[model samples]
Target: MQPINLAAKLALIHEHWMPKVVAEMNDYQFKLVKLRGEFVWHSHADTDETFIVVQGRLRIELRDGAIELGPGEMTVIPKGVEHKPCAPDEAQVMLIEPRGVLNTGDQGGARSAPNDVWI
Candidate 1:
């Protein structure tokens, strides 16, 4: 297979909070989202969510505390654990999760991103 250029794929995205699928392995999907401001608090009852920061900074907030990440860093929020992702500015993030999991999880609403979408 040919290589996938993250920056090039990311450039094609124009909207924030929208994750475009780039690759998949078995039942897992790899996605890219441009995060700005703060996301709603939510939790996936069936699966965990992984956030890998490729550029800029990211802060994942939980009820007790928050975990901050930057370029080349990542963190996993366990299933059923409520969390909110925030970015003071735009941040490029890679998400790894099951194929059908919703971005907004149990709190799906206007902020929900479509599932199984590709770049």
Candidate 2:
């Protein structure tokens, strides 16, 4: 199989908060998303969501506190826990979750991006 170039894949993404699928492993999917400003407070009821920062800074705001990540850093938000993701400027990020996981989690709204979109 050919290697997936992250920078090239990410370069094709111009919209913020839209997660585009890059690859899949079993029932899981790897997604690339650009983050800026704030995201709605949400959580997944049935699965955890993992965020891996590829460029810039990302802040995962939890009820208790917040976790900041930079390039090559990552964190997993446990299932059913409310959290908001934010960034002061544009941040390149990757999300790993179940194949059908919603970008906005359980709070479907105007910000929800369609699931399983590939770049």
Candidate 3:
């Protein structure tokens, strides 16, 4: 395989909220996303979702509370937990989730992007 340059890879992305696949292993997929605004409330019933911020900041809002994550910070949202992700400005992030995971979880909304297709 060719060498993977994360810096160069991250430079190719120009959109927001859409995640681009960077690598995959076994049943999991690793993705990079640049985000802004608010995402629809959703949940994954079968797999946990991990988010790692590479730059800027993000917030995950749940029914009970919310958590703010900054650059170099990471958090895992357990399966079946309803949550919404938001960013005041813009944030670069990495995500780890099971293959075939739908970004909107079971409850799809207007914000749900097409799944499985790598950007």
Say which candidate scores most in lDDT: 2
The C-alpha stretches of model 2 lying farther than 4 A from their native spots are: none
Q: Which residue pairs collide, candidate 3?
A: none
Candidate 1 on 1-119: residue-level lDDT in tens?
56889999999889999999999889999999999999999999999899999899999999999999999999999999999999999999999999998999999999998877788
Model 3 regions more than 4 Å off: none
User: What does candidate 2 score on TM?
Assistant: 0.98
Question: Which has the greatest TM-score?
Answer: 2
What candidate 1 gets wrong by more than 4 Å, as runs, is none
TM-score per candidate: 0.97, 0.98, 0.92
lDDT of model 2, residue 16 = 97
lDDT on C-alpha atoms for all candidate structures? 0.94, 0.96, 0.86
lDDT of 2 at 36: 95
RMSD of 2: 0.6
Worst lDDT window (10 residues) for model 1?
Answer: 1-10
Clashes of each: 0, 0, 0
RMSD of 3: 1.4
